[model samples]
Target: MFELSRRNFLSQGAAGVSTAMLTSLTRGDAPVSEKKYAVVDEVAFRGQTRRLKLMQGDRYMAALIFPTDYPTHFRLKPELYPVCTPSGVPVTDTHQYCFIHHQSIMTGHGKVHVDGTDHAVDFYRQLPYPNTERIDKFHKTHNLFQMGPSGIQKIVKADWKVTDQIQLRLILDWQLRDKESSGGKSVISEQRRYKLFQRGPYTIIDQFTQLSPHSQSLTLKADRHSLMGVRVNDLIDPDDGGMMHDSEKRKNPDGNYWDISGNRKAPRWIDCTGRIGNQTAGIALFSHPNNTRNEFYSRGWGLMILSPTLGHDVRVTKDKPLQFAARFVAHDGALAGKTADELSDEFAAVDYRKMFETEK
Candidate 1:
């Protein structure tokens, strides 16, 4: 286990920033000070996607992409692309064909129900199958909704606030195809927020998802893929040369459902690490203690998901929305189990769902 002290982490950042500042001076440009550097910078919001750059000083850390198109894009969701380590090695792969739905760092759910309706909607697996790159057929008609097997999450509104930390809030309508017409019905109103900050040598992403029924009550049925997911780069996949570690210390070599249990006990955090170029980099996902069902689906093929609705049914009422929170750590080296535990403790101390109450 690699134990990294707080002092060592700051020294590492200082060393890198010194070199970058020197390079800027050589180029005859005004050097950017560490204090004035923006962590999250909006790159572009056009066409079918809204992209943001996660940065450290002048270097690129990651790209957060939110798909604006609905049924047109097979997987209509937000994800982090090319998540790089501090040394500039990409630690996440968003273009893995075999698991096209496995986005770099995204959120998803499956087996959703709208009160008394028999509508079985899935937003996890996605359309046109997982392995194929062929696009799912889109209706060219003027109908507002494109009927398909996948549930669509259209961003009704998106707003961001950049303080010491960056907060991106999205108001989405979880729409499902209406079996009666060519249109779709909005079953749920979702408020998703991503609060990002820098901690030590890690870029910490805090995600909070609140789902309320549009009109009727909602039921999130038991599903293997319910909430947050992290798809590591191919180089870090265990099949290539990576490793996975969880709070429970359970080993899953075949990507099976070993951690999915009838009981409520589950791992608090999971880390996936491997060599990216010459540096060891990885991501750690931590589940909030307040979550009702915090199960995980970890795979050796570079996919790790913290599924909250697995093996249990969750009810979401109008008065009380189904709210859950998670934390993702993107760091340059293999995160230690002790460090994961400490981070998980810190995560549990805060109620991240409180931030979701206000619409900034």
Candidate 2:
């Protein structure tokens, strides 16, 4: 064999290393040669027949599923809202349905009816506002509203991904029937589009910029005029209005509700700021302009609620579709806006497409 010099030996070694890396990169199913990022696995909860997955990547992100089934709905309280004291003894309760996190609040046992009537359902918890005394006020529903079979099918395309930012897309479709009212019987059919983006660990840039092109042409028929509003509640205080002073209300009289202010003919958009567990969360609500009622916002720190009706007496006719879209973006710190005027301006500038389209 020919003797090799030290330089030649080193050159050969470098060539071998480069070849190996090239091969690994070109291989279709090669084992990972480098450290891989974390991946989330599928998890199942009570009342969820199908398993849901939590995904996290360069950024921490998760989708909290809330189902419409009564068993699952009632189970959410203790499972997700357990009392955790930073310094004191952790409270424990054997009761299946208890608001132990907010010990001062009363717990009622009942089911949410089809007519949108829910007994023993705390509106404060379900639709809370600022200065509310109820503790654990910001508790979210177990899942988004139950969309039934057809509605669920439409959302198959809906999912979320997180990279340096968070992106969420949801498609909701449903047929509304009017069985309660007689006058102005008609059908309202439409589709809603929602998108959100996030930057940094806690800063969220949200957008509710699109509606189905077909939505503007559709007229939603409701027995009574229906409007969509946001509901916000604080979860850290007692269950009643104990901490709210009359002066506080006068100082910030908005009452945590923000109406979707825009043209009633095209898709209407609203932007608001709130807090989630000390972390600020941005919200964007979108609806078609032809919707019978204007969009309303029930917005508050620790809680955010969106209602399509004011008196809860609204009814949708057959063949009509009632659709709404919402986006939640976690921010790095408390939001900068102090009033709706300031908040709306900040929301208007957020570029939704860039937030969702950027690769992590």
**For candidate 1, what's the RMSD?**
8.6
The TM-score values for the models, in the order shown, are: 0.78, 0.38
Off by over 4 Å in 1: 1-46, 69-74, 128-148, 177-183, 251-265, 358-360
lDDT by residue for model 1 (5-114), tens: 75355335544543553466588754322433254545342454456776656666567776643445445667878665554556677748676778888877777777
lDDT of 1: 0.69
187-209 in candidate 2: lDDT tens per residue? 12223232323233222223232
Cα lDDT over the full model 2:
0.28
For model 2, what is the alpha-carbon lDDT of residue 354? 35
